[model samples]
Target: MNEQQRVMQIFQAYREVNQAFFQVMAKVAQKHGLTPLQLIVLRILKEFPDIKLMELSDKLNLGNSTTSGIVDRMVKAGIITRERTESDRRAMTLKLSDKGTTLWEESNDMRLMLLRPLLGLSEEDQQQFHRIQTEILTILKTIKGDVLHD
Candidate 1:
C-alpha cells in the first residue's frame, strides 16, 4: 500500500481499539449503576474534593447547565453532596458522599480489566508501547490547533 493508505489504515485500527475500550468501560460502569460520565465525575471528585460547579464543568469540558444536571442527578442518587462554600456562600462546591467513595473504590476492578491486555505484553514491549503513545499524544497536541482549522 501507499504511504497515505498505510497511515489511514493505522488510524482506523487506533479508532477501533479506542471504541472497543470505551465500550467495555461503559458496560462496566453500567454494571455499577453509573454512566461513563458519572464514573468520571466520581473520579474527579475523589481527586479534587469539594470542587466548585464551574470548575468541575471546566474539567469535564461541558457546559455549566449540563454539568449542573449531572451533579443534580448524582446528588439525588445520594452519591454526591452539594453545599455552599464558606468563603463564597453564593457559589456551591461538590463532594463525593461516603457511598460514592466506596463505589469509586469498587470500580478499581475496571481499571485492572482495562490494563489486562497491556499487562500481558512483555516488559520491553509495554515500555515501547508507552513511549510511542506518549510521543503520539505530544505530536497531536502540538498540531491540534492547526489541524482544527481545516
Candidate 2:
C-alpha cells in the first residue's frame, strides 16, 4: 500500500480501538448508574481535587455552560460537591463527594479491562507501541495549529 493508504488504515484501526474502549467504558459506567462522561469527571476530580468549574471545563475540553450543566446534575445527584473558595467567595471549587469517591474506586477495574487487550502484545511490542503513540502525540501537538483545522 502507498503512504496515503497506510495512513488511512492506521486511522481506521485507531478509531476501531477507540470505539471498543468507549463501548467497554460505557457498559461499566451504566453498571454504576453513571454516564461515560460522568465517570470521566469522577476520575478527573479524583486527580485534581477542589478544581474550579472553568479549569474542569478546560480539562474536559467543553464549554462553561455545558460543564455547568454536567456539574449541576452531579451536584444534584450528590456525586459532587461545590463549595465557595475561602480566598475568593465568588469562585467555587468542585470535589467528589464520599459517594463519588466510592464510585471512582469501584470503577478502577475499568482500567484493567481496557488494558487486557494490550496485555496480549509482547513486551517489546508494547514498548514500540508506546513509543509510536508518544511520537504521534508530539508531532500532532507541534503541527496542531498549522496543519490541523478545528
Candidate 3:
C-alpha cells in the first residue's frame, strides 16, 4: 500500500478500537443501571466536586439543556444532588450524592477492569504500555483542546 493508504489504515484501526472500547463501556454502564453519559457525569463530579451546570456542560462539550436533562435524571435516580450556592442562590450546582459516590466507585472499578490485564504484563512491557497510553492520551487531549493546565 502507498504511504497515504497505510496512514489511513492506521486511523481506521484506531477508530475501530475506540468504538469497541466505548461499546464495552456502554454495556458495563448499562449493567450497572446507568447510561454511559451518566457514568461519566458521576466520574467528573468525583473529580470536580460541586461543579455548576454551565461548567459541567463546558467540560463535557454538551449543551446546557442536554446536560440539565442528564442531571435531572441522575437526581431522580438519587445519584446526584443539585444545590444552590450562597453567592448565587438562584443558580444550582452539581454534586455526587452518597449513593452517587458509591456508584462512581463501583463503575470506576468496572472501567479499570477493561485494562486490568495490562498490569499483569512483564515489567518492561507494563512500563511501555503505560508510556504509550500516556502519550496517546496527551495527543488526544491536545487535539481536543483539553490540554492539562497544571
Candidate 4:
C-alpha cells in the first residue's frame, strides 16, 4: 500500500477507537441520568471548578443562549449550579454541585474499572504509554499545524 492508503487506514482505526470511547462514555453518563453533552459539561466544570458562562460557551463552540439553556437544565437536574456575582448579578458563573461532583467521581471510577487490566502493565510500559499519550495530546491541541511557524 502507498503512504496515503496507510494514513487512511490509521485514521479509520482512530475513528473507530473514538467512536467506541464515546459509546462507553455515553453509557456511563446515561447510568447517571445525563446525556453525553451534559456529562461533558460536568467534566469540564469539574476540571476548572468555576467558569463564566461565556467562557464555557466558547470552549464548547456553543452560543451563549445555548449554554444558558444547558446550564438551566443541569441546575434543574441538581447536577450543576449557576451563581451570580454579588457585585454584578448579571454576570453568571457555573460550577458542579455536590451531586455533580459525585457523579463525576463515579464516572472516573468506572473509567478506572474499564482500564484496570490495561493499567496492570509493568511500570516501564506504563510510563511509555503515558509519554505517548502526552505527545498525542500536545499534537492534537496545536492550531491547524501552526502553518506560520513552518
Strongest candidate by lDDT: 2
Candidate 3: lDDT of 9?
Answer: 85
Candidate 2 stretches with Cα past 4 Å from truth are 110-114, 148-150
lDDT ranking, best first: 2, 1, 3, 4
lDDT of 4 at 68: 90
Clashing residue pairs, candidate 3?
Answer: none
Per-candidate TM equals: 0.89, 0.92, 0.80, 0.79
Sliding window of 10 residues with minimal summed lDDT for model 4: 140-149
Q: Please, what is the whole-model Cα lDDT of each candidate in the order they appear?
A: 0.90, 0.92, 0.89, 0.86
Distance from true location, Cα of 101 in model 4, Å: 1.8
Give the true-structure RMSD of model 2: 2.0
The alpha-carbon lDDT assigned to residue 141 of candidate 4 equals 63
RMSD of 4: 3.0
lDDT tens readout by residue for model 4, 1-150: 999999698679779978988988888888878888888898789888779988998888999999899999999989998888787889878899999999999987886677678767999998997797687678766845786567
Model 2 CA lDDT for position 114 = 60
Residue ranges of candidate 3 with Cα displaced over 4 Å:
120-150
lDDT of 3: 0.89
Worst 10 residues of 3 by lDDT: 141-150
Residue 92's lDDT within candidate 1 is 91
Return the lDDT, model 2, position 20. 89
Model 2 lDDT, residue 141, Cα: 86
